[model samples]
Target chain A: AQSVTQLDSQVPVFEEAPVELRCNYSSSVSVYLFWYVQYPNQGLQLLLKYLSGSTLVKGINGFEAEFNKSQTSFHLRKPSVHISDTAEYFCAVSPRGSNYKLTFGKGTLLTVNP
Target chain B: NAGVTQTPKFRILKIGQSMTLQCAQDMNHNYMYWYRQDPGMGLKLIYYSVGAGITDKGEVPNGYNVSRSTTEDFPLRLELAAPSQTSVYFCASSYSLDPDREDTDTQYFGPGTRLTVL
Candidate 1:
């Protein structure tokens, strides 16, 4: 079984400021990682994923994440944020042997204020 | 392409009532999943189907049942609705189950259905 843990429950940042959402996972074998964003009253949308290759993965909306194998962390970062970027972000993981079925973190709320 | 569609955007059920959430996808994906999002919680997989006539339980499968009779449709049934079942339900589809598939880790989600049990 695989599990994800989002360290922060909420993060508030001023518009145009950088933000980072921390995520950690627990897995005994290889894993796939992903980040998803959800707007109010809407479904989730893929932000990015790290399967293999480059440790730095870029995503939509000027977001990016780095996969640190030693730490078992895949934290999402945005150089600059906008009001529209305020939403709930989720980190998920799936074990190598299992199907694409994912295990998601509790979620972090990013509130970008003007 | 109407990637994924879920019917009854909002629903309210009384205690002990039963209902089924309908889901359909047009992407011709072979893998379909049902997930629930609670307040302040990320989506939790309720059930998943690799293909027609095949289904498996997920992390939170209690009080819920699912059936995938065809590749295009997968429905989740909630029996004896309870307050714990109140949450936003989302349907997602992917092209394959193989972790390394070309479209792996890419899941298209539906608009979501808000269900409240009182």
Candidate 2:
């Protein structure tokens, strides 16, 4: 079985400040990592993904994540955040051999205040 | 392209009532999935279909049923509405078997349907 864990449930930060949302996963087999964002009253949208490449992965909206295999972690980072970035973020994992069945972690609410 | 669309964006049902949530995708995707989003908790897969005739259960399948009768449609049936089943539902589709984009199996999501059971 595969599972995802997001350490922080809520993160409050100021606009233009750096932020990091931590995520960890446990899987017996090789897996793919993904980050998704959900704004108020909207469905989730993919932020970034790590499918087997360079450890560092860049995503839209000036966000990035580093997939650390040894640490079993994929943490999403942003150099600076805006008020519009206030949303709930999620981390998910899918095993390589499966048909893209994703296991998602409890979301982290990122509140970027001005 | 209206990649994925769900009908009855909002609904309120009485306990023990039954209803079906309709989902359709215009991207010609081979794979489709249903999920429920609860507060604090992330989305949980309810069911998934690999093609028109194949469907499988996921993390949470109880109190729900799904059918895939065509390439463009997949509907989820709730036999008995319960408060526990009240949540935002999402439908997603992806071209999972496409070999060209093997590394990036991105799933496109529908706008979502909010169901309330009272």
Candidate 3:
């Protein structure tokens, strides 16, 4: 079984400020990590993913994340925030060969203040 | 491609009532899934289908059932609705599930269906 933990429940930040959403996972086998964003009253959109290769993965909307295997962490860091960036972020994990079952974290509500 | 689409943007169900949540995708994805989103809680998979006529249960599949009759549609059925069944339901699809395929890492989601059970 795999599980994910998002450190903060809500993160409020000012526009143009940098922000980071911490995520940690636990699994006995290799896993794939993903970050998804959900706007109010909408479904989730894939922000990025870490399947393999480089530890640093860049995604859409000027978002990037670093995969630290030793720490079992995949924290999403965005250089600057915008009012439109306000949304709920979810971190998920799918163990290798698990038939695509994703274990998601509670989620971090990112509120970008104007 | 219209991606994934779910019907009945919002719904309210009385206790013991039964309803089917419709999900369709134009992307022709081989994998389709049903998930529920609760406040402060992340998504929990209820059921998934690898292809037409092939369905499987996920973590929270007790109260729900699913059917995939075609590559484009996967509907979720609730036999007996209860208060706990109230949540935002999302339908997602992926082109493939082959680990070797890069697209397998991402899933496209629908607008979602908000269901309230009372």
DockQ in order: 0.63, 0.67, 0.67
Per-prediction TM-score: 0.95, 0.96, 0.95
User: Cα RMSD (Å) per model?
Assistant: 1.6, 1.3, 1.4
**Which candidate ranks first by TM-score, i.e. highest?**
2
What's the lDDT for all of these models?
0.91, 0.92, 0.91
Tens digit of lDDT per residue, candidate 2, span A2-46? 999999999999999999999999999999889999999998898
Q: Could you arrange the candidates by DockQ from highest to lowest?
A: 2, 3, 1
Clashing pairs in 3: none
lDDT of 2 at B67: 94
lDDT of 3 by residue, B1-118 (tens): 8889999999999999999999999976898999999999899999998889999998899999999889999999999999999999999988655677667646788999999998
True contacts kept of each: 0.61, 0.59, 0.63
DockQ, cand. 3 = 0.67
- The TM-score-based order of candidates, best leading, equals 2, 3, 1
Please identify model 3 stretches exceeding 4 Å from their true place.
A97-99, B97-102
Docking class of 3: medium
Question: Model 1 Cα displacement at A34 (Å)?
Answer: 0.1
Model 2: per-residue Cα lDDT over B11-117, one tens digit each: 99999999999999988888899999999889999999989999999889999999999999999999989999999999998776555774347777898999999
Q: lDDT per residue, candidate 1, A1-114, as tens digits?
A: 778999999999999999999999999889989999999988999999887899999999899999999999999999999999999999999876454568889999999999
How much is B13 displaced in model 1, in angstroms? 0.9
Clashing pairs in 1: none
